[model samples]
Each structure stands twice: as structure tokens, then as C-alpha cells.
Target: MSERTHDGGVAVTAAPSPDESLPAADLAAKYGLAVSGARPSLVEYVRQLWGRRHFILAFSQAKLTAQYSQAKLGQLWQVATPLLNAAVYYAIFGLILDASRGMSHDTYVPFLVTGVFVFTFTQSSLMSGVRAISGNLGLVRALHFPRAALPISFSLQQLQQLLFSMIVVFLVVIGFGNYPRLSWLLILPALVLQFLFNTGLALIVARMGAKTPDLAQLMPFILRTWMYASGVMFSINHMLEGRPEWIVRVLQANPAAVYMDLMRYALIDGYGAVNLPPHVWALALGWAVVVFCGGFVYFWKAEERYGRG
Candidate 1:
């Protein structure tokens, strides 16, 4: 209540009574408090994540370091692992299946190595993403940040590893007598699109595996099937030649095959327009857009549900 004083027309205000109930808003404002455990809007979440960019990079590098910490050769194993796989594939697909008979022995090794390294990038990114959130529950519980960072950092860790392995890849290309060309500029665009595509897959699977942890186990078999379909070891065009047009289109349009074809066209003399699918760039750009946006939205929709369970 406010009262006027007799002296000099002064006004005085009375304090609230002890028995009067304080308004919730007034109490909160007085205490400078906020809602606990409230989820932010998607925009706010993204902003929060952006604010933590350094943390993401550091987390990714740390994981990359820890990946080989137990191994004797350390980072060399990253390059050696895929190269060894190439050797085995070269044996089976190169020897038993006679897939290498058509291409020059000179470029075929480079072609196979490129496919192994490129595909392994996506494979490793997604595999780590499948476990990103579920595997880091301790950190998740101990911290409060956007869970999306986990998958994104995992994808980045793989990309960093891929770049490291690319040092060996370029050497292998040179060892086989291929030199860098104007066409090699295409590797940037190819890796960019593929990285975006892998990030999308990572987010999609991270959310999925968060709910169904078994996805981690099942992904390898699914990826193995994908590798066969992607034509990592052999030219699928020959096998798909006699098939119906739709099947041929499907095989050619597979993202993994499109990327490998792009790299071969960029890096190898024998693998270009004659074997390339029509509109390869269009197919690649479409896959990147569709998967990345769709997966980001799908993942963001579950922002509040991530660590509660």
C-alpha cells in the first residue's frame, strides 16, 4: 500500500506482509533463477553446439588418438588396415574372380586402394557414430551439451583419419605411376559430399543405436552387403550390363559406387565417361542434401529424449 505523508507531500510504500504469498515469477526473478533441465529449442541447441566448436574438435582428436593408443604401430595401423584389406580383396577378386584381367595391372591396384580407403571412411564414421552416444553415457551424464556433437565429432574423427590415410593413398597412386592431374581437383568435392553424406548416416544411426544398441552389431553385416553392392573390388558395370535398365541404374546410383567412380575418374586414366553413370554429380548432390537435412531434423526432433533413458 502507498500512503501520502503530511510533510512536503511525500509518499511512502509499505512492504509486503509476511503472510502474503509471493508470486512464482517474482520469486524466480528475485533469485535470478531459471528452469532446471529444460530443453532448448532447435535453434538454441544449434547455437549452443556452435559455441562448443572447440570442444568438438578436441574431442574428435582425442578419440582419434585413443583409437590407436593400444596398438604397437599407432596411426600406421590406420593406413595399414585398409591396405591389408585391399591385399586380401586383390587376392580374391583380383585372382580368383579375375576381375583385374580387364584393367591395366598398373591402375587397378590404385583403383582398388581408392575404393577401400574411401568406403572405409564412411564405414568407420558410421560405425563410430552408431556407438557415439551409447558408448559415451558417462560423459553425457557428467556433462550437458548438445548430444549431436558426439556423432559429428565421431564423423570428424573418421574424416581426420581418412585424410591421414590419404597421405599413403597419394603415395600408392604415385607408386603405381599415376601423377596428380587437373582432374584430381575433383577429390575435394567428392570428399566434401561424402563427408556430408556420412554425417547424415551417422546422425541417423546414432539416434537409432541410442534406442536399439544392437544396431552396432548388425551394421557390419549390413555394411559388408553394401560393400559387395557398391563394387569396391570389381567393376559392377560388367556384372550389371546384361541386367534390366532399372537394376543397372540402381547399381550405378549407389552413393558408394558414385564416389568410387568419381575418384577413379579423377585419379585413373582408364575409368571415366565410358563407365560413369549419367548425372553422377546430380545423384551425389541429391543424396547429400536429402540425407543430411533429413537426418539432422530427425536427430534434432529427439533432442530432449537423448540421455533420459
Candidate 2:
């Protein structure tokens, strides 16, 4: 069999003449599966990711800093915006509606803060993903980096905001005398899961939005509707009142809602003593895997296309 070096590692063998059957090694080598150095498998994919973890971190940090660099407030906007939103909502819901009839006024602030904080990350991910390619057309055409990095960077920027918002939420919770409990430790893993979810979503939308700019305009309405449907202002349990079990199930199926509930339970309810249902967590995980794998495949398919202006 005729062999050629592929990527300076594997020997890729060409198909044999019509009369001769290619050996397995030759066939495998043809597909870049030679024993010497095979193409990456899923495990290798993760290892490759691990090796480049620094790049991701650095890129994300740079993006975060660059976004705020031009602003007078700089990174303080990350803390300020969420706090402002919480205050507005608190005024309307707490003062006008007196909505905290059952819940304490102070407790309601953190609850709303947590919901808005989490929802803002999702909004930023989806909205930025929608504009990712269009907004970075110059970078896309001029540079060669992972296309996923654009949306990933945007999501990470929002994640930085989320982290800052969480600090504010923690302070608000403390001031309210709601000291964190051991159960609050779950926030670490929950935040990780939330990040995975956001990255996956950004990947999906960035690719789709690259092809259709209309999504950029359409995303905000969708996000607003999602904010309402997600029970950001009121509790999901309250919204689902008198609705059928299946309807509640359908609403709960929203992975964002599940995460919101988890965040509320951990940070607000104190380690989910009320306990977010297992199915909710399972659904969140399932969506994360599906979105990540599917979006990665879809985005990678257009990797070469991203270079086109």
C-alpha cells in the first residue's frame, strides 16, 4: 500500500489496487488510525481540552476585561447592574404587590437577586451567541482560532458578572441574617453545571446566528418571554397553580428553570432542604450533554466557513 504522512504523525495508506484487499492496518492508517498515533477519540478530546485549558481561561479573562475597559465604571458594572435590577424588581414586587406575604421581605430580595443573576447569564449567553459571528466578523475573517472560543468567551464574560452578582447576593443574604449553611456548598457544583449549560447554548446559537442574522433581533423577545416563563419574578410553584401536572412538567422541563430552582434551593433555601427534585437535576444534566455534544458537532462543521466574511 502507498502511504503518506498525515499531520506528521500517522501514516495514511491509500487503497490497494482493485485486485488486492487492503490489510486492516493499511485501512486503519488510511483513516488516520495507525497504531503510531491515531486521531483523537472522545477521551483524547477531553485531554486536548485539558491541555488547552489555559488558553480558554486566558481568552475568557481577556474578553471580560476588554469589555469593561472602555466603560467609566469598568467591572463595577457587573456588580451594579444586577443590584440595580434587584432594587427595581424589589420596589415593584415587594412594595407595590407586597408579594412577600409568605416570604420575608429580606428573603425575597436574595431570591429575586439569585433568579435575576442566573437569568442574566443565560440571556447574555443566548444574546451574545446570536450576535457572536456577526459582531466578530472582522476577527473571524482575520484570525484563526477556535470559533467556539468567541461564544465561549462571551459566556465567560457573563459568568464573571454572575460571580460578582453572587457576591452581592451573598452580602445581601448575610445582611438579612441568612448566613450560609453547609448545604450552600452545593453552589460550586451547581455553578459549574450552569457554566456548562451556558457554554453549550452559546455554541449552538453562535453557529445558527452566524447563518441567520434575524435571530439577533428575535432573541430578545424570546429571552423576555423565557424570563416570564421561567418564573423569574414569582415562584414556579405559584405560577403552576391549578395547572395540570403535565403542564407543570413541561415548564419544569426548561433546563433554565431547573437551574434557577437549584440555585434558589441551594443559596436561598439553604442546600435545598426543600430539595429540588431529582428529575430536575437529571434533566439539567441531560440538556447540558446534548447541547454540548450536538452544538460542538454543528459548530465544528462550519469551522472552515467561519473564515468567510
Candidate 3:
């Protein structure tokens, strides 16, 4: 038997005697207390995140500002760093290493610049994802919001940075005699798919980094190797000419290389569908969907465990 208290009819019950036992489920239902750190269902989790859209956008912008606040170059570094790297590659590949592989000077420069800028978006997203949870442990522990926010906001920050750099990319393209075309419209969908892909990658890496923390140390080398293999400074097709057909197809189909090829076909004159592997857009969309759906579920599964350790 129980007596009601004045505080919203909360029950006051006598303590159980040694002979009595209370069912945990019944007690929980009566008291309405959920298990601490319980994960939400996917639909509910997404609803909660949607309720916090302002916070995510604001946080992303704040992080972007803070990243360049101390540097004398400020936001200029975002554009300059990639341009400088492109210049160095121009000298090395175009001149010394012969990575240009007989492509016209105009064509190779634009190709390299667009590839560097586009690829860096994904590279930066993964790098920042590694730190998203680990770097914000204090906030994660103190706040009741979704942990996915951190990784997603980090991805947005990178996206904003890349958008800023795209202006320079267009200028570089114009300088090399590649003007706008109907194909350039494809960049819109291409970038949208890539953003999804990057977000998925960010979520996956954020979970991994939150646990291991050592993954961050190895990412740089991994990205560097990927850069070389992605045909950023040179054409993988030209490099692998006369090689087995399957081998050439495999490299072209890689997500990174596929994205670079799409952008090249869109922005650089004469780099069209024929130069690309079959089903380029289809492969890009497939990778984006698979990675995003898989990554979101993967990260959501670990929601409750993110900040505890």
C-alpha cells in the first residue's frame, strides 16, 4: 500500500521488508525513470537533431572563425595553402617528375588544381572528424545534445572552407582557358553527394577516434598515400596505360579518384565523359549512399558510450 505525496501525487511507499521483492520493471514504470545513457531509436534521434539545427550551424561557423583567428593570413590561408601546394606540384609534376605525362600545360595545371581542392575537402573532413569527439570531451560530457553534432559540425566547417577555396579554383580554371560549360552544372550534384560521403566518413572516423585516439596519428600517412593513388597530380589512366583492363578500372572506380574525375569532367575543358570510367555518376551516388547510411547507423549505435570513457 502507498500514500500520495502533495508533489504531483508522487507515491510514498513503505520500505520493503526482507521477505518482499519489487520487480525492477514495475518500479521503473511507476517512477518513470529511464536507464541512464540509454540510446534513442533512430527516428527519435534524428528528430532531436533536427530540433537543434541552429546550434549546429552556429557552432560550425564559430569553429571556422576560430580556426583562422590567430593566423596573420586569416582566411587567406585557406585559399593560399592549396594554391601553394598546387604550384609546387606544377613544378614537380609538370617539370621535374614528368607527372604531366605529355598532357598540355594548360590542361594539367587546371586538372591538378581542381583535384587538390576537391580531394582536400574529404581529407580535411576525416582529419577533423578524428578530433571532433576527442577534442570536445568536456562539451560532450556536459551537454545533453546528440554527439553526431560534433562530427557533422566539423564536416560543415570543412565544407565552408572548401567553398571559400572553390573561388580560387574557378579562377585557376579560367586562367588555364577552361570556361564555364553545361557540364559545370554537374558540380552541384557531385558536391552534394560528396558532402554526404564526407559526413559518413566523418562519423565513422569520429567513433573510431573516440575509442582509439591513435588513429589520428596514422591518418596523415594514409591520406598522403591516398593522394598519390588518387591521380591528384597526374592521370592514373596515363600512368597505367597498357596495364590490365581490370586494374585500370579498379583505380578509376575508387571514390576519391571518381570524384576527382567528375570534377575534372565538369570544370576542365576536354575532360569529358569518354575520359571517365563507365557509370561514374552512378558509382559516386552509390558510394555516397552506402557510406552515409552505414556510418550514421554505426555512430548512432555508440551514442551512449561516446563520452563515458
> Highest TM-score: which candidate?
3
Using all chains and alpha carbons, the TM-scores for the candidates as numbered come to: 0.88, 0.79, 0.93
Ranking by lDDT: 3, 1, 2
lDDT of 3: 0.90
lDDT of 2 by residue, 1-309 (tens): 545576666675877575358878678767776543223454554566566667777877887778779999998888888779878888987789765555666667777888888888888878877788878898777764566677877787788778867888888777876787876887887777888888888988898898888988889998989987876676655545688877776776787887887788877653243335457667777877888777777766676666465
Mark the regions of model 2 whose C-alpha exceeds 4 Å error after superposition: 1-52, 98-101, 270-278
Query: Total clashing residue pairs per candidate?
Result: 0, 1, 0
- The residue-by-residue lDDT of candidate 3 on 210-309, one tens digit each, is 9999999999999999998888999888888899999989989889998889999999985766669998889999999999999999999999999885
Alpha-carbon lDDT, every model: 0.88, 0.75, 0.90
Alpha carbon lDDT at 70, candidate 3: 97
Better of 2 and 3 by lDDT: 3
TM-score between model 3 and native: 0.93
Provide the global lDDT of candidate 2 against the true structure: 0.75
